[model samples]
Target: PIPNSYWATPLLLACEYPWTPANPNKPKLDAVLHAGVRTFIDLTENGELRPYNGEVLATRAEFLGIDRQAIEYHRFPIHDRSLPESIEFMYSLMEVLRDNERRGRITAVHCRGGIGRTGMVIGCWLVESGRARNGEEALAIIAQKWKTVAKCNKYPHSPETGAQAEFVLHFE
Candidate 1:
């Protein structure tokens, strides 16, 4: 896991991109490998990729003398601080989670800071997976879980925007 990473479930981890913010934190390829992450989900689009050191895909180790084949990388990006536009995208994301769970694989999902976009996806997954009753419930759960792990804010904004929250609330 990266610095602020935490598990939303035993199998689903919420974490920052390995090379996020591109500063002293650096790429935590070794940490991701050591943490036993198997399914890596990226929720950031290409424009969001510009600020980071580079995109961190499971297939690309971004490190020398290290094998990253064990991790399965996936990209189902949406706009920054936004919800996925298509129902099909949500279906695909959930399908990946289901498939990975069936394989006994632990998955990690990330956007740049692992907050807004990451939280939106996790919240939607929570509702869809029946772990949460509704969007409000899911956001509350996220706030608790995220704060416990990251300590980034006294009042962390999981779905940073109202529309993002609404999408989760009305998520099918």
Candidate 2:
């Protein structure tokens, strides 16, 4: 793992968008290539990541290769501060995370700033992976590790919004 990396699981990490605009705000996969992230699970939409004028909405995801030709890069573009639009998509995302870990792939999951959206998915994973007994425990673990980072979605909770929290709470 990298120095400032945050882990959702030993193999799965939570991070902000791994790219910035300053380096032309492009996808900088090489920057984190040393982290040995064989897989990247990006939970951001196209516009949500990438370089911007005001600031570079970056993440610490182990490594995200939007390069398309990389060994692995999976994107699930849910809106910020929100849950996945569909239950099926959410299931698929969780399945991928679980599968990647089981396969021993060092996977990374990221969203804008690695806060609300990141916390939501990672919290769900904590339950899904059996790291926590339930969503409440999962949220507590994430909130403790992230501290102030968990308040972005208008809630002092890991999943940020009610819908997100509920989704994680009832996640299968």
Candidate 3:
């Protein structure tokens, strides 16, 4: 696999919530709850990660006293980067994130390193937030913020899939 240029988003903050990293250097936990984050959304991939355990995230939420009711975790596989089904899974994940945001919930979203998958989710959020006019512009904004660019599928498995990915990301 080719190395990506960008680091993922550590935490995407909305007006309703103030987000802070678990640790300033490497934010393992999405967003700390006591610091005004009403909802904690863990968007990381699972199934084989030993250190970033899903149970730990749940435990942190329980410890934070953040009502645990507001948290959501949806796992979408990140391997096989060129798969259309994977791309669709990302979209479905976006729908879940967008719904909470629409309800005025402040969400702290994160994945490993806060880059690739994290960046894509953040890009979708920006689009949904109207902070970004389009997907192209959103990508540029994200690249600028993180000092790294997202990859365009150079080996897109199918023309239709490539076109589908391109179509949704119009503003950036």
Candidate 4:
């Protein structure tokens, strides 16, 4: 988990959905509740969920005993490297984060692997929140944070693609 000191109040998390076959025994729901996460922003598209080979996110959350009413779930599907639409979705995501922070709720953002689209959205948030002057700066901060998380978690974590990096660098 990213340390709370990295950002202001109402922590925002970018991670992969936890109910994968490779990690069947992971106590993800318990971890989320323990971390005080009250909001989930799912960046995976419906089509990706259906034809793909993974458990449904909402079903997994429900199975983990998450209260549907207690946590807000926002689904904003962003195709890789799609500019204008991705930018629009980022605005909506920022709005949700703003609202959740106002209510003192911790927010979690997730995609399939939690590096591509997730990183993009976070970079956008950093810029939108005035923590960074531009997309490149935002990405730099994200890269630093990703390195920290990857080291702490003992996993490979970073933005997934050159296109994703470019998207962050050019995001408005």
Candidate 3 lDDT, tens digit per residue, 1-172?
0123232232343211112335543232433444444544444335424343355555566776655665655455553222325656666767776676577655555444344445556666677667778877666676565532233344221111334336448522
Q: Please give the range of 10 consecutive residues that has the lowest summed lDDT in model 2.
A: 53-62
Kindly provide the TM-score of model 2 when superposed on the true structure, using C-alpha atoms: 0.74
Candidate 2 backbone collisions, by pair: 16-59, 16-60, 17-58, 17-59, 20-25, 21-25
Winning candidate number (lDDT): 1
The per-candidate count of clashes, in order, stands at 0, 6, 14, 0
> Local distance difference test, per candidate?
0.75, 0.67, 0.47, 0.65
Tens-place lDDT per residue, model 2, 65-155, is 3333334777888898888888788779889987888888887777766777778888888888889999888888887766534333454
Please, what are the lDDT tens digits per residue for candidate 4 over residues 65-124?
766457566788876434327456677888998788778788887776677777777877
Please give the distance, in angstroms, between residue 4's alpha carbon in candidate 2 and its true position after superposition: 6.7
Segments in model 4 whose C-alpha atoms lie over 4 Å from true places: 1-10, 21-26, 50-68, 80-86, 151-157
Mark the regions of model 2 whose C-alpha exceeds 4 Å error after superposition: 1-5, 24-31, 51-70, 148-157
- Cα RMSD of all models vs. native, in order, equals 3.3, 5.9, 8.2, 4.7
lDDT-wise, the better of 1 and 3 is 1
Best model per TM-score: 1
Worst 10 residues of 4 by lDDT: 1-10
Residue 117's lDDT within candidate 1 is 81
